[model samples]
Target: MDKLKLYTNQNFDQLRQRQDPLADQAVEDLIANPSFIDVINSWDIIPDQLSPDFSPRVRNFLQFYFDKQSLQETSVLQNGQDFFAKNGDIYLGLLGFYSLPYCYAFGDGAEVLVRSKRIVQDIGKRLAETGVFVMDIFRPNAFISDSRAYLTCAKVRLIHAFSRYFIQKYARDWDPKFGKAINQEDMLGTNLAFSMIVLRGMIKMGRNISESDFEVVLQYWKWIGELIGVDTSFWPENSKEAFELDRLIRKRHLKSTEAGKTLIGALGGYYKGNIPDALIRQQVDGLFYFFLGKEASNALGIKSTNALSGNLVDLVFRFSGWKNYGSKKSYEGFRRMMEIQQKEQFGEVIKLNLPQVIRS
Candidate 1:
């Protein structure tokens, strides 16, 4: 066996022991890349199933996210071109939905993150040596991280999309000065349906606001999911809270889920940028439905192994928050963390506007 393939396979074994879907997805991913597989398939797959019991629907969705997306302009990451692809940002953004849930259920996401980082590093190392562009590194970690970043960027992008789509649909007069009507379909991608599902999860947790506010994004997501034949209720729908509370959290992002008065606290933060007394629960109620037996799960093409992939993210909402003055003051905190991430990767941040017109 080639040393590199051996190294990667060993890493995958440890990942399998942890029972991670993203890691499982990574192998199939590496194998899918013509070049990467060309070299590794000769090495023989040990256990065969990298992630046993992966859902066909989700596996297709995740693999499709990697295969189809890339970064869009206004991306905070300077190196955006190096990371994202068509709908890449949304794909990565959905991955972030799992962070709070995973952290609560899995304890520390560092192992997963490290494994992810390793995938990125290995892919980078491989590409760097050959100077070959294998369509977004073709590595498992890159798949997860890119997918995560895609999710985060999706939230921001969808917010931008919401701003645009909402204006076009309802308030055409309220312009943010970007330009004339944008092709919402062109801007957000078919994946926006799934992205809407994510925003829905964020909103459902608190039940603090109207689904109408973000339903445009959801509509777009539905279009995309349907294009690929996925169920519309990809997110938790039945146990959702009221709209008013959901709105409170979306505008203002509370740091922790296990706090009190989350809506009140989120409101203050939305209006003002201050952390209120909305006590962030030290422990997020991660698996209310997540940790529950399989019977309790909504199971949108998920399994015990693949559960890490957005299958349980709505649980982030289950963590209660206190709506203290301080908490409301510090809502919509997604900005700061994102800014920090850009700043940290400032050196590697690469920016370029891809021509929307792909030449034949």
Candidate 2:
């Protein structure tokens, strides 16, 4: 793939406007691209038996989500893109450590993460690299064009599908009480965690995201959810609806599971040596506490950091304001932290890998 061609954003509006099969064209272009093909083929191919066809109900669910109105050029898009540009690093942290763990709190989902077992050895580096990919795709150009974003979305959907297959084939005797891995509810919960939970975390961290910016961010993630196979009817049209749906999902599915507790411990252990200095580490811990809050922390059994250190971190954000928090210096510091983790853990810049089925 020509790197330059990959850099340009697609004219999403024009494609939507056309009466032709623009969605099909988009998918074809995505898969045909050399870079995307490489990413997909690199994943471990599971036997076809494990990869069953989508049930009719699942097919209808997808159709309902995909048949939504086209995204148009508006101030919302501008504000949404601007929000990312200004606070990309903050959002990165929220997505990486804060919001992502909720997936593990779901018993079946936790089983998938723990059973995969790849995350334990290099959790910090893996998470940081994932964060890097997310930040890259969340950029204004990438978000609108749906180029890199589409690729990332596809990877996420495939991982869920692969995990579902793995669980059904290998863990049939697994306790039915935990529910099915990557079932519709679990899938939607994960999607909500990525979008609504991340947005809420950002606000809790003291970033003053305007209402318009908030809506646009939701819109951006909604599109991502669609690309990643979330049902359209499940997509929230606004933050209020998102929060309601998230609450309902959590009330129904979120619980303390052994797998979740273990994953949390592994994550904390990974961060211990990677954060550079005591102060930074303390700040991170505090931010985690603030974002996760008492209810969630207790649910995951996440230990509290030093109270003073956590408060200090919160104060820094409270006083810094959004612009300063997302300043060039701040972004540089964020990038440097990730780079150091990559070098220390991998001995080089680490490339993102598609999540593969765990054979063992």
Error of 1 at 94 (Å): 7.8
lDDT values, one for every candidate = 0.29, 0.57
Model 2 agreement with the true structure over 84-110: per-residue lDDT tens digits: 666665566567567777676666567
Pick out the ten consecutive residues of candidate 1 with the lowest summed lDDT. 349-358
lDDT of 1 by residue, 1-360 (tens): 122222233432232223223323433333233343333223222122324344453244344444434422222222222222322322333333332222222212112222222223332222122111112232223323344333222222222332333344555433333222222211222233234434444443443434443443344333333323233333212223213322222222223222212221222233232222132231122222333224212221113443332333433322222221123322123223333433453433222111121224
Clashes of each: 64, 2
Clashing pairs in 2: 10-145, 65-232
Per-candidate TM vs. native? 0.25, 0.70
The candidate that wins on lDDT is 2
Best by TM-score: 2
How much does candidate 1 score in TM-score? 0.25
Give candidate 2 regions above 4 Å deviation: 1-78, 143-146, 283-286, 308-311, 315-326, 329-341, 355-360
